[model samples]
Target: MHLRIIALALTAVLTSCAGVQVHRVTDRNQPGIRYWRPAPYLALVETRTENAVACEVRPLMLPDKTEEYAITINAGLGSVKATPTLTDGWNLVSLNAEADSKTSENLTALATLLKTGAEIKARGVTKPPTQPVPTCRGVFRVDYDAAGNFKGFSRISL
Candidate 1:
């Protein structure tokens, strides 16, 4: 009876771990490139610089598997979404900057107000605030096999 209980507990822990297993594969040729396989059909590539971080989500299986989507997060700015294009790949979706510290403070204040049921005022500004041009620190081109398995990634110029 005691052995049965221990067996059940062990099985539960192993099953949970399997569901959250992530494989990190590094390429010897490209030392800078990093790969993470979070799921069977999805792979994530990330590269970081002093002031910025970039990530790309490459689908292993898709009708047009050659495409890749990338996003960059700047220290001063929030997240910038990019879409792949034939001519200029990974075009910025928006031009918005969020001051990290100030944004966090504002969010905390807003959450406090909501908890207290305080009235909030909404203001509209005519002109959109201009932000500095976002720099592309590192861009990569991910390769996959015919069977939809990730081969590796190579650094590409913007």
Candidate 2:
């Protein structure tokens, strides 16, 4: 029995769950951290037991404007949390958007940030209500830049 329990524990440690997908957009015409889904990225998790699901994507912004955007998404069993922040990376063009900087100013925000044919990265997914270790159903990601500046964020619950 002891050996079986140990083996199970080892298996769980070695196994990892699939995470949500985040996409990037390149249309300069679009304003702000663009979050567009051409092909639907289906979330396989649940919204009840796995009540927390989110995904965030970092845009391929200009080297100078890269630092201006950020994204952060969080979720849990019962409820979820979100926040957005902007840095100096924003340029004159973003001034108008930044003035209201809704995402940056809003302490709690939930918004997708991306489009198609982009490098999709598996960010994070958290599952709360676990006895000991809080496991997540989907993914949660904080969109950041090369200089470590935040652009946006997301949380997905399947």
- Candidate 1's C-alpha runs over 4 A off are 1-136
**Candidate 2 structure quality by residue, lDDT tens digits, 1-158:** 99999999866543321111222334455333433221112122333436655432222222322323323222211222222222333311211111122223122221223221122222212222112212334443334568644444445443
Residue 79 error, candidate 1, Å: 42
> Each model's RMSD to truth, in Å?
21.7, 25.5
TM-scores, in order shown? 0.17, 0.17
Q: What local lDDT does model 1 show for residue 134?
A: 35
Candidate 1 residue-wise lDDT, 65-118, digit = tens: 222222222232233222212212222122222322334433543354233222
The TM-score of candidate 1 is: 0.17
For every model shown, the clashing-pair count is 0, 30
Whole-structure CA lDDT of model 1 = 0.33
- The global C-alpha lDDT for each of the candidates, from Candidate 1 onward, is 0.33, 0.30
